[model samples]
Target: MSAIYDRVALIGLGLIAGSMAHAIREGGLAREVVGYARSAETRETAREINLCDRIVDSAAEAVADADLVVLAVPVGAMAAVAADIAPHLKPGATVTDVGSVKQSVIDAVAPHIPQGIHFVPGHPLAGTEHSGPRAGFASLFRNRWWLLTPLPDTDPAAVDRLTDLVRAMGAKTDRMEPAHHDLVLAVTSHAPHLIAFTMVGVADHLRRVTDEEVVQYSAAGFRDFTRIAASDPTMWRDVFLHNKDATLDILGRFTEELFVLQRAIRMGDGQQLFDYFTRTRAIRRGII
Candidate 1:
């Protein structure tokens, strides 16, 4: 791996950004990596851990003369961060984001980008339930998918450069239309997370089940639900709010499937239950 950018600025020193810092350093993908976070404590932690070559006090300072600027903040904060850094961006610099909800983030940040800069929206399909500056590792993105939803008018050279950098950092890159990406993510990520949160909440609400028993007896299935539910609430809330329509569409389909399963259980339709499970099991096998 060699240097792809002279300088890369990362805004928000959380899990994704921190992991990127580690990966960039490990791969030598950027000559200089600088970062910023809104929280003073987060900045202190980043400094303590040497998360980046330089940790700046402001987003503006972090992005000064940067060749690549990555907005790694929450989806809801994209616009504000974009506005703050827009005026400071170098003329030929490329700006990209790690927001899960592509359309809303583009709507928020695109208007703030200056004329000569490139704005490419992206989402990396990789992470653990863990977060914060200390929770990242260089291999977090290894063999994981990094989807970019660049606008049709975006510069091909800029997109190619970004793809090179991500690939060097151990991710497989793919490009898609923004709206289609949102819908795909809704089925693959968002709705599943919502179901996990709901299942965990149901366990909490069940009076007949003691909390101790639920904790002690949680099988692998329920434990996986808890892991998904443990994702950052602020990030998940913004994701759901921004991606409402796609998520709702997927959730509606999921509800219909759930109702069918419920009816099968109630009516003792063993054939229907077995066939449904068999088909779904095949899908899991495909994923594996």
Candidate 2:
């Protein structure tokens, strides 16, 4: 165990922030963790949970003298958080974020970062449907992918420092351009979450009409969608609102493919349906 940073400031006290606190404490990655949240209730809860060495009232107050600052807020709040912490961050301190969408986060936070500080936009491809400080577990990052989208002029030493911190938290690290990261995640995570939310909504409506029969006999497939759809509404809402373009692009492609399958089913085109099933099955096995 090694202390990578003398002090680490966390800008939000949600699941991701709590997990980071736990991970850093368990691994001795930071000498101290200072945290801030918008709601007084959340800050109080974070203190009760003992997630940080210190909990403060404002973002500016938290980042003072911290060697590394992690903005674990929603993607939509990146710029505002960056603005709040900019003046307080010590020179040469590293700043990063745990946002789902990378491009928008980079766009929002990059301009607000001061010249002497390092801004390394990152996304940990991990989390459960749960939200709030209570939902976090120390092992959430184990075996997860932590993606870093560093700017071209980013200092190599700072990049390596963040990468080491990520690995210390039990996540393996990867790198990509911010735009590519957003596009890939739009198809993999964002689109699936949207589809799950829609399906759950549709099922609930159908259940209302049919008197709850759908829930009574739900199979594994629909049940899984329900679990995913049960995710925190505020987080998902922020994700969709901030990553609109990529999400809509993927949704358009999904709709087009869905229409083709619908036509095959309507026409009783057995061979086309069989081929589609086989192809999808192969893809599924490939994932394994």
Candidate 3:
């Protein structure tokens, strides 16, 4: 594909931004990609690996005259970063984010985006247990969902341009309302990550009581839980904090369902247990 933007700026050197840089360059989606990170070490590492066409010193410098600016920072820092770069963004540039939660991101970022510069909030439903610049690959978004949650008043041309870039990077693009996006992600990602973290914490406690047998006798179930639990802590912290209401809502539902399964187990209600497991097994198969 040809270049989607004359210059693209990445505001963080983490997994998502790094992957975007790689995908954009490999697919010829942008003429130039500049990146910035808060950490000096991260910037140095990105430079060593040639993660971006240029590694800049500040958020303000990174977005200078850029056509597309990707806010890949933690949700909690979105507002600050938006403010820092708002003054430097090009007149007709588009600003987007890779935040997992959309509504809160819009709440934090939209007000800072200057007039004429578009802000189309987006979240790519793709990642790995690993993070950082070195963990990125050009094919990370291949065949994955890249959801955009543009405000109703956003420019249609800007949204279409972003959709074109995402599709060119080998992702499937879909637009949704911001609030609905948060709720869906809460059910699909946030609640599950919390559950995984809790399960791993419980296993850590059990290991103390059982003389580390939990680790020694680990199975696929526990391993998978740990893998999910191993996601970047700072990112997860911001996700739960920004999307609190929806995450709590899903957790309440999960707890109610857990009580039902717990009762079935305690009573040895074989029929109920079988039916529940069968239904859930179908969900797993459906996902595949």
Runs with alpha carbons beyond 4 Å of true place in candidate 3: 207-212, 285-288
Worst 10 residues of 3 by lDDT: 206-215
Alpha-carbon runs more than 4 Å astray in model 1: none
Preferred candidate (TM-score higher): 2 or 3: 2
lDDT of 2 by residue, 79-103 (tens): 9989988988899999999999888
How high is each candidate's TM-score? 0.98, 0.97, 0.96
Point out the higher-scoring one by TM-score: 1 or 2: 1
lDDT score at residue 288, model 3, on the 0-100 scale:
98
lDDT of 3: 0.93
Task: Tell me the spans in candidate 2 whose CA falls farther than 4 Å from its real position.
Answer: 207-212
Better of 1 and 3 by TM-score: 1
lDDT of 1 by residue, 121-202 (tens): 8999999898899988999989999999999899999999999988888899999999999999999999999999999999
**Highest lDDT, which number?**
1
> In candidate 2, what residue range of length 10 has the lowest lDDT sum?
207-216
Instruction: Report the lDDT tens digits of candidate 3 across residue range 7-100.
Output: 9999989999999999999998999999999999999999999999999999999999999999999999999999999999999999999999
Candidate 1 lDDT at 250 equals 94
| TM-score of structure candidate 1 | 0.98
Ranking by lDDT: 1, 3, 2
